[model samples]
Target: MNSIISEGVQVSVETFYQPDYSNPVQSEFMFAYRITLENHNAFPVKLHRRNWQIFDSNGSHREVEGEGVVGVQPTIQPGESYQYVSGCNLRTEMGKMKGTYQMENLNNKQMFTVDIPSFEMIVPMKNN
Candidate 1:
């Protein structure tokens, strides 16, 4: 798991390699990641957008940017948290991902960016 705190928001990530969904012969690897966003500020926050940078060990790279996560913009209350699961496909056995979330302070309607700590996804056997 990887974690970071930015702008009073805590972002943590845990990655899982989905062997069942991966085709080693085809050079396709699938990974699922769970992200937890915790609001440490005194005010509530609403997730507005997300931007991701994905890299594969094969020298492949991509950027993903869009509104919300998993199709919904979540609102996290002060001292509360929101969790979501998302998937990514890589051309290699190892890869890393990092991103940022654009969030709005519900109390003041101010926008801020929170860093999502970098996390790695690797086929279990590849770790050795």
Candidate 2:
């Protein structure tokens, strides 16, 4: 797992290779990642948006920007955490992902960015 803290928010990520969902012969690889967002601030925070930079070992790169995550925006209270699982597909056996979350402080309505540490996804057999 990889974690990073910024603006009093902590982001942790764990990734899993999905063999059942991938077709290596066709150059399609699937990976699922679980993200946990922890609020270390004294007040609650709401996640508003997400931006991701995805890179593939085959030299493919893409950027994804969207509202919320996995569908709904969640508000995490102080000392609380919110978690979600999401999937990504790559044209290669290995890839990496990193992003940022836009969050709002519930107490002051101030917006801030929380960094999501870069995480790698590799096929189990490719680890060698």
Alpha-carbon runs more than 4 Å astray in model 1: none
Clashing pairs in 2: none
TM-score of each: 0.98, 0.99
lDDT of 2 by residue, 3-89 (tens): 999999999999999999999999999999999999999999999999999999978899999999999999999999999999999
Candidate 2 segments exceeding 4 Å error: none
- For each predicted model, how many residue pairs clash, with residues at least 3 apart or on different chains? 0, 0
- TM value for model 1: 0.98
User: Can you write out model 1's per-residue Cα lDDT over 3-58, one digit (the tens) per residue?
Assistant: 99999999999999998999999999999999999999999999999999999998
lDDT against the true structure, per candidate, is 0.95, 0.96
